[model samples]
Target chain A: MVPIAYYLVLSAVLFSIGVAAFLIKRNIITVFMSIELMLNAVNLAFIAFSRQWSQTTGHLQVNGQIFVFFVMVVAAAEAAVGLAIIIAVFRARNTLNVDQIDLMKL
Target chain B: MHLALFIIFAGLCVAGALNLLLQRHPINSALSLIVVMSSLAVLYLLLGAEFLAAAQVIVYSGAIMVLFTFVIMLLNAGKEERTHGSRLAYIAGFPGAAALLGLLTYIFLSHSATFGQARLGEYLATTDDISRVLFRDLLLPFEVTSVLILIAILGAVALARKEH
Candidate 1:
């Protein structure tokens, strides 16, 4: 009796939160987290739609799930490289505060 | 009820995201993000995307979150920022958050009228069917993902290398 719309709405709420956090947060780590939040929100919507259509046509609709798998793999790689970059930046700057990082202006 | 489960998962996801943003310590933030990822995997399972649920847990929580935790530990982040909370941030952050949530509610409510409802059981195909479609139809993206992963690995190494 679960409705796909419920899942979609939940995903939308998450996505909006991510967007707001990404735009407003000052800490670099917080911003990175917001990006991950957005990606997860998208994955939720994918799975919801996949389920909805599968039950309608009765043909094993796993494409959305497959896409989710790929997204997760890519997200892992991204987090690794992104954290490395953040580490390097912290090493050079001595601060993770976003406002203080203005080195490109020179 | 299924609605209750949806509410629980949604609450968990939002709570985790909020903790990630509000926690002063990078390590705590990293842990909260992992919680978010795990809850998302649970939601995926409920949605009948078992493969996605497994991948979500393995990749996001197991691998990516560990990397984030390691980086935070390595950097010793949030060691000096003793003062974490701010009254000014509460004023600005909460209003913006509330506005966004309101917008989402409006969108979903309006869209619900036009959105097509499909029966979920009709789409149940075997894993072989999924595998076949993925390999045959999505071959290009699959190969591209491999290349992307390789590049990410190389980039991480380059970033970690000591300067000569």
Candidate 2:
């Protein structure tokens, strides 16, 4: 039997991996991807929790899923804007190496 | 049946994330992320979050991934740039990753031992329930937040535009 705890644990592991990748990766695009991975991990936990609690209500109490929906929406908007910024940054500086973009230094 | 499908989707998601990490090209990584997103959507469906699943497909796989692909294509980021980081990162990264995983394992184990298994019933909280709360109770805030996000999006685009 697959316990909800198992799913939640997997989700947490995935989220931690994403966070590690996000922090360690220098590639701007990869960092963006790590963020997406983290979001997906959270979504998994949300769905798992929703299902685990859905047994008593006869209907599903899936507020977590709804929260995931909002998260996805925000993530989409964030991606669009984030990529646009990255694109612009790449134009000014020929490299997407995040460590090299020191434009703020006096 | 549900467990089987969940396992399959979960495996696919994990595989896709690993591939994204190992792939040499940014485009390949983006594609792998899409696979991960799609698998997550399937997992959402299996968990009976139908609306969420559809939204996941539409938002993440559709809009967000498309944006990522376009950006990757625009940058023309080659394997060389992708791998240009310091060797120091790998040395430090491995231990950091290990520590995070260990911490997570500890937390999960501790929580698992004590967490109560709460049982909700059918129609516990559906899309309609969310709609009722969102549209009826939180309508103004919802609209305001949307407008705020839209403005931020436009502002970001404008700021990102190259000056003549």
All models: lDDT? 0.75, 0.74
lDDT (tens digit, per residue) of candidate 1 on B1-164: 55677679879988988777677666777788888889988777676665666777877888777777777777776632433334555677667767877877777667764444433333434456767888998989988899999999999989977677
For B61-150, candidate 2 gives per-residue lDDT tens digits of 887888788777878787734444556667787677778778877776677634334322223345776787678866886787688689
Task: Write the residue-wise lDDT of candidate 1 on A48-76 in tens digits.
Answer: 77776676665567777777768777887
- Once fitted onto the true fold, the runs of candidate 1 whose alpha carbons sit more than 4 angstroms away are A55-58, B79-101, B113-127
Give me candidate 2's interface root-mean-square deviation.
3.3
What DockQ number belongs to candidate 2? 0.48
Q: Residue B11 CA error for candidate 1 (Å)?
A: 1.9
TM-score of B-chain for each predicted structure, in order: 0.79, 0.82
Model 2's CAPRI class is acceptable
The RMSD of every model to the true structure, in order and in angstroms, is 3.7, 3.1
